[model samples]
Target chain A: MTVEAREARQPWILLTPAVSAVLLLLFVPLAFIAVYSFWLRTATGADQVGFYLDNWREALGDAFYRDILLNTLKIAAITTVFCALMGYPAAYFIARSRGNKAILLLLLMLPFWISYIIRTMSWINILGVSGAVNSALMALGVITEPIQMLYNEATVILGLIHFLLPFMVLNVYVSLEGIDETLEDAACSLGATRWQTFLEVTLPLSLPGLAAGGLLCFVLAAGTYITPLVLGGPTDAMFANLVFEAIITQLNWPLGSALSLMLLAVLGALVLLYNRYLGMAQLMKGLG
Target chain B: MGWNLVRVWTLLVYVFMFAPVAVVLLLSFNASQFGSFPMTGFSFRWFVELAENEAILRAFRTSIVLGLLTALISTTLGVLASLALVRYRVPGANMISTILIAPILVPEVVLAVGLLLFLNFLGIPKSFPLLLAGHVIFTLPFVVLVVQARLVGIRRDVEEAALSLGASPVQTFFEITLPLLMPAVLAGGLFAFTISFDDITGTLFWKPGGVETVPTQIFAMLRNSISPEINALGTVMIVMTVGLPLLGAAIARRMAAGRGA
Candidate 1:
């Protein structure tokens, strides 16, 4: 081949392995699920080879699945709010600091280096009925009975916040870090109070991070299975947990795929909405 | 200034971040069988017990292999993808990058189950290579992102200069580009390794029975109560994940400083 043709062909050649893998493994499998969502499963846990919309029909019509969807969205929304509320101040503090910013950022990321399952289970030892918190509370005469704090929405939220808070903090920190400190200083010199300057200058710029972090938290919370498996009770199962139950326990692949699609659709909608409002570039900046 | 509010908030936030890990590490040393309640005297008994556990040891070995292999595969693909994106003006480059990275966006559970079903339909048994392929799918984005950041500064003139001196394309890549790109390549590989090693959701769904990675073993162990062996495992993993990366970052930073100076 000529040099120009060789150069032209090189990019495609280099990309062949990765592109094929995505097409085969990620994209095609997801497409398989999309097709399987409309098919029926057999008694032997295999999908029948005919197209039908029964799975989607049942998923859309069933109050049980509807409740799971709503509960998943609700839990995700609540978790996002809690993470943002807790993460914003910490991120702001780190961003506002002059030196040791890298150190603080590293500290925030330390927890994420460990296993997700281990971190979720750690709450059991700390929050169980006979665990440290209840035992300490009982000793202090906070209540006669140890509070039922282990398996509920409260515990689930706490676990999610613990897991997701670092992401939020990191994203918000990136956004705040990108803001020109001189602008805030200028606002202050123009007679704006510290609060006023923060309100008018800093927070608006940090909105991109807030939106990105909030989206990350929402997606994670909505799809979390393990945390809820370990920390939540029967009543608090999210849609992912339902998907897990349907596939692993009930052997309902068709229903499971349908639920998976629903979760994916919901998350995709939120992401699109976020991009429309906050700009995809800002969210993309926080990901690496 | 009333920024003491911010100061106290910072302290509380740090406490919240460290508390779970500190508690786990403490309990890992507890002498009592019940993970709950009063601690008996601290001992190294659990750490010792972890050494005798064959399953955990095997899982650790498997994990190291998996991590290394996944890192290799993903970094190769990622470096190639990065080169394609940076060096060539291709149609749909942005769209292609987005699609390649979309694996990170999709929930791990969805990817896992879908892959499981897809493999089953294809009649491919879950094996080591399959597991590696799955891990590569999840981690390729990290490698690309890390390398892409570093690739931008590498001027096109350097390659052209090498070529003008009669070097072949491959020679130009190795003798010129690869050496310069080494730091970023290593960083990307490290990210891929760490991600594959710590993977839980995708690993759990797609793993063949009787073949347990560290996380899967830990999952099984947690069904009872948190054991000292598991604690030892977590502690070791934490050290590897954070300590090694920091060490590498320090070395890279030193190299950069020396070059600049």
Candidate 2:
């Protein structure tokens, strides 16, 4: 082969294994789901092959599914907001700190390294009826009885915020760290108040990080299954829980695939919108 | 005074972050079977019980084996892909990069359902091999991202100079480029291993019948019952998770400083 041809071929050769793996494992499965979403599930729970729109119609037309989707979005939105409120200040503090930044960053990352399940379980111990919080409250005479804290929508949101706060903080911290310290000093030197300078300079500079972090938090919170399942009551089950029950418990793959696709579609729409505005390349760079 | 407020707020945030972890640590040593408050005196009984629990031990073994396999395979593929992307002006490089990282953007539940459907369609039973494949797909992007970042930071002139010195491309890669990229490769491999080991959402869907990884097993156990042994297990995992990365960072810093000196 010619040198140019060989050089061109070398990249494809090197990329073959990784690219093929992604194709076969990731894309092919997603295609299968798309196809399956249009197929019918028999009364006996077996998949009936061939194109049908009943799954889509059922998922979309039913008020129950609609409410669940809305509820999922609501929970995700609340979680994202809380993450922003909590994480922005923390990230700012970390970025501005003159102390050991590496250690502080490591502390921020410590919770993430542990299993997510374990972290959620810790909440159970803290919030259960006879758990730590209740015992403390009772001991301090703050309440007459243990308030039921576990297995609720509030707890679900709390758990999500807990899980996602690190991502938000890390993203914001990266952007905040990138900002020139001189800009903040200049704003102050120009007689801007602390709040004004923060609002005008620091906040605007870190908006990209805030947007990226919020987007990630929203996507993750909306799609998470384990947190809701472990921490939520019967009324708090999200769309993911519905998909899980349909496929695993009911053995109804067609309906499950339909629900999965719908969830993916909504999330995929948000991602496309995000890409349109901020660019996926830039988002990934911030994340990395 | 304002700075003090910020410091207090940051301290509170740190406390919030560590609160649950502290609870897990404290509960692990409690003598009570139920992980409720009011310490019943510190004891290692739960740790002993955890050691004796066959189901959890077996699941832990499965997770460790799976993590090692995932690290090995994903790291190998990631290093090669990183080299290609970093060194060569590959056609469709942007598209390839996006495709590789797309898995991270997709929700784990969504990916799990898709994988389950695909496997069912193919009449393939869920097993270790299938789980391994799923993990590699989930983790390869991270490996690529890490190794690619390191590769980009490295000066290309070193490799070019080696090539100009009459060394073959293969020799230059091994003798020059590989050494520079080793730390990133190792870090990426460890990251992949940790992710695979801690994964439960995807594993829940694809794990073989009658088999469980540690996280899956923990999830099941927590759902059915609360026990001190689970807390003990959590503590062990926390130690490893926190300890390993800190240790790795320290070693890397030492090596870097030594080379500088």
Candidate 3:
């Protein structure tokens, strides 16, 4: 075969396995879930062959599901704000530093590689009744009791923030790293105060990164299961946790699938917003 | 502007970030049976205790095997797919790329349920290979994206020169292209391995009876409370995960600077 022919064939040959896997595992299954969401769970444990909007109707209309949705958004928004607040200064410091930036960046990113479950559990060891935080407080006589720490909304948020902060820092860092240092210098030379220049130039340009990071933090926090499962109170459940309960404990696959589809719908809408406003390149860059 | 102010702020951030993980690590080494604070005398008992825990050991073996297999398969597929996307102007390239990356964007719970339903419908047994397949699907996009970034930096003329010199395509790729892509391939492999190693949702859904990975095992144990053995494991993982990647990123950064200079 000619070289061009061989080269042309190679790409398809290499792409076959991945294309098939993704189609089968990711796309096909999601399509099935979309279909399942329309079906009804029967008196027995199986999904019934009926087309209805009950799942969607319940998800939108029921107060329980509505509360879960609102809680998901609340936790995600809080996590995003905290992450950005903490992450920006850290990313800025690392970006501005000379020799220490790489080290600082590494430290921020290290927790990402460890298991999310482990990291969430680490908080348990630190914040549980007999855990470290209360121990320290008691040692210092700061509180009379081992304050309730784990299995609370505060602890759930703490775990989500801990897990997500690296992502926020890294996204902002990537954007900051890409900005030309000369622009900041030029702003300074043009009689702009450091704060004024930052407000006018740096913040707007970095807004894409901020939005991307916030979206990511929100998606992850909203969709998370292990954190809430491990550290959250019974009432602190997110929508994803409800999906888990429906599947595993309740044995209601159709309802679980319906709830998951609702989560996906909201997630898809938000992702669309990010892609439109923030740009896909920026979103992907932030993810990396 | 004050140096001390900067120092205090940075110190607080560092402490906030590292303190919990650090506490877990410290408590793991304590001689006390309970995984708690107020240091008892140091001992290696948990490490030994971890070794003796058959469930933990079984899960560890499963995780390592899964991670290694997933890394190799995903990295190979990723390298090839990345080469395709980068070198060829195929139709539907954008769509192909988007679909490939869609897994990363999809919620894990959704994917897990979808995969379970699909596998059940297909009558495929949820076995080790099935779990491996799940992991590969999850990790492949990451490998492709990272490897593609590195591949874009490679000059095509180098490959063209080899082709013009009567080198076979395979020869050119092996001698020139593959070697140049090594850093990225390794990086992608590391990424895949880490994701596979840490995965819980997909594994939990797909894993067969009597086969549990580390995260799944820890998750079951965590229903009671966080164990000291997990803390020791986490400490070891923290060192390797952070240490190795940082070393690689630093090396890459230095190389880029050196070239620029």
Most lDDT-accurate candidate: 2
Better of 2 and 3 by lDDT: 2
Tens-place lDDT per residue, model 3, A23-83, is 9889998998888878887887557867888877887789999898888989999999999
Question: Model 3 clash tally?
Answer: 0
lDDT of 3 by residue, B159-255 (tens): 9999999998889999989877877888899899889989987777788887889889888887776667877777766766667676877777676
Question: What is candidate 1's lDDT per residue for A1-288, written digit by digit as tens?
Answer: 898999899999998888888779899999999988887988884578678888998889999999888988888888899899889999998988776988888888888777777778778778887777888898898888988788898899899989999989989999998999899999999999999999999999888899889888888888888878778887888888888888778878888898888888888788778767876676667776
- Clashing pairs for predicted structure model 2, backbone only: none
Candidate 1 vs candidate 2, lDDT winner: 2
Give me the runs in candidate 1 sitting further than 4 Å from their true place. A138-146, B254-261
lDDT of 2 by residue, A134-220 (tens): 999999999988999889999999999889999999989988998998999999999999888999999999998999999999999
Candidate 2 lDDT tens digits, B41-65: 9899999989999998999899999
lDDT of 3 at B252: 72
Provide the overall lDDT of each model, using Cα atoms, as 2-decimal numbers. 0.84, 0.88, 0.83
RMSD in order of candidates: 2.0, 1.5, 2.8
In model 1 chain A, which range of ten residues has the least summed lDDT?
A: A275-284
DockQ for each numbered candidate: 0.67, 0.78, 0.62
Output the number of the TM-score-best candidate: 2
